[model samples]
Target: MYEAVFHVRGEGPYERATAESTTRIDLWCNDHCDLLSIVGDGEELVLDRIREAVGVSQRLGDGDDRLIVTSACLKQHAEGYVEQYLAAHDCLTLPPLRYENGAKVVRVLALDAANLTAFYRDVASDYAVTVESKRELPTPSVDAPLLSPDALLPALSPRQREVYRTAHEQGYFELPRETTTAEIAATVGIERRTAEHHLRRAEKKLADALVDAL
Candidate 1:
């Protein structure tokens, strides 16, 4: 998967208070292309609404006094119209955008059911944006080891180890005991029945060890 973030700032005739709203507008535009899709001879009214919500003031001084606006856009077709709009508005200017400065990053990843290359290509064609960086990750590893103190006492299996730990940690045998098998099972992501079985086995092993010691 791949992701990119944009950091944007605005100044000039534009009101700075709505910088966040303006960023959201851009994000909304990217997510819903219908807001910017050409329908006639002019831009959509949605853009006007976005500008109003973001507090874009009227162009002042032949738009010479620029509003320093910077924000990042993530998509394959990342450039194009937003850049054009910034240039056209004269009230808005975007400097270099980055992920660290609160730019929204979008991630593109490969799924088991879909061809990644085609999906990425389609997204790239649609967004035409570049990723700042990329990295490959290894598959996760799994390990299961016995973790019960009762196992150290003898005649105990790995399963009993876990059960012993839970019973002690959960105070299963204490007066006004805290925690139940169902709760312990939920915590360990095991079935309640299995938890009970393990607890019983662990208790029996510990009891036998104690008797032997006596």
Candidate 2:
């Protein structure tokens, strides 16, 4: 999946209040979207809700102020929504924003570009009010193999390899344990459910491999 991040900066009456308020607005939008009956698909609805929640009414005065908005989404329609959001709000500046953290970053998997684009569009349309500047980001892939040190290494898929590596590196097998399932999920950029699935599959494979070895 392709990912994009947009950054917006503006000056207006609510510039100072927008940062923290925008976050709350996004959450509120997500909650409202969750309650919509017509919103089909959980992921789409969540994205729409976040946009709608943040698109509340804000009265700006004649006084000059500046505000900035940053958005990140998968590469399909996210940019469109961001553009729409800026248009709807009459935001002053619109530009591309990049997220750089040297090496480690989050990655999203999509079946194809179409699916990724669709996800981005949904997010952009919902939060049209406060977004000033936005940009699209490339999704990163994790190349590490997901396998245990045991013979089962050959059977594990790429995802499984990541799960196993994360567990091992984080010392999941240690007496006290240094990380939890949730932590592993965060590290691997997968949901807790996905993380759990990989871990379980890896463990079962390792167990069977150990028995065979015996």
Candidate 3:
């Protein structure tokens, strides 16, 4: 199996909403409406903008840290062409679709590499598309660990993951510490304090997961 993460920029309400705020919106389409879990700063402002964009919204729970809501599905709003195209090509896009920055990051799976290529070509024709990451997985063993990264570390937000990854790659955890928080912040385009905050959160989450596993 082949896995590819595609960053797609479009005019969909979710995409537009995330573009205007520093929030991340994860989407799942239902038969009648779309289910969304929104997180990050300025969620209230983003939610209000989304309500204006989609016209109808029903908020679930208090939505202080994580907001769960339902709105009109993209298919009903005539903005589901890319989804339809992916379906036609037999590419499965794993949900919830992640909307960050100005694009929707779609994690797709295809049995054949050619199918992935064709799907990317078709979608890129209508919207801006970029492949953020692609990798071929080895077949899982029967004795493989039950806790995958996705299953074990759901608490780390997108920003936390990015900051942690940046720090790791730059050897911030090395014996001599090759990189500083300021350098990581500059690379990630976030304020140093903000980067440090995310890194600390990520490290704590990772530590907790590891200790629990042990």
Task: Please give, for residues 1-214, the per-residue lDDT of candidate 3 as tens digits.
Answer: 7888899998877777778776777777786777777666657776776676654467664432464555666567657766787888898877777888879888888889888999999999988999988888666578973223454555455677789999999999999999999999999999999999888867876797789668
lDDT of all predictions: 0.38, 0.40, 0.76
Better of 1 and 3 by TM-score: 3
Clashes of each: 16, 34, 0
lDDT tens digits, residues 1-214, model 1? 2222222332311113222221211222333221211111112232343244432322212110122122222223343333443333232222222121123223332222133334434444544444543333234346743222322454333344566687778887789889788988887777899778767756765687789668
Q: Write down the lDDT that model 3 would get.
A: 0.76
Each prediction's TM-score against the native?
0.28, 0.30, 0.74
The residue-by-residue lDDT of candidate 2 on 47-82, one tens digit each, is: 343344343232222111112121322222123333
lDDT (C-alpha) at residue 182 in model 1: 91
lDDT of candidate model 2 versus the reference: 0.40
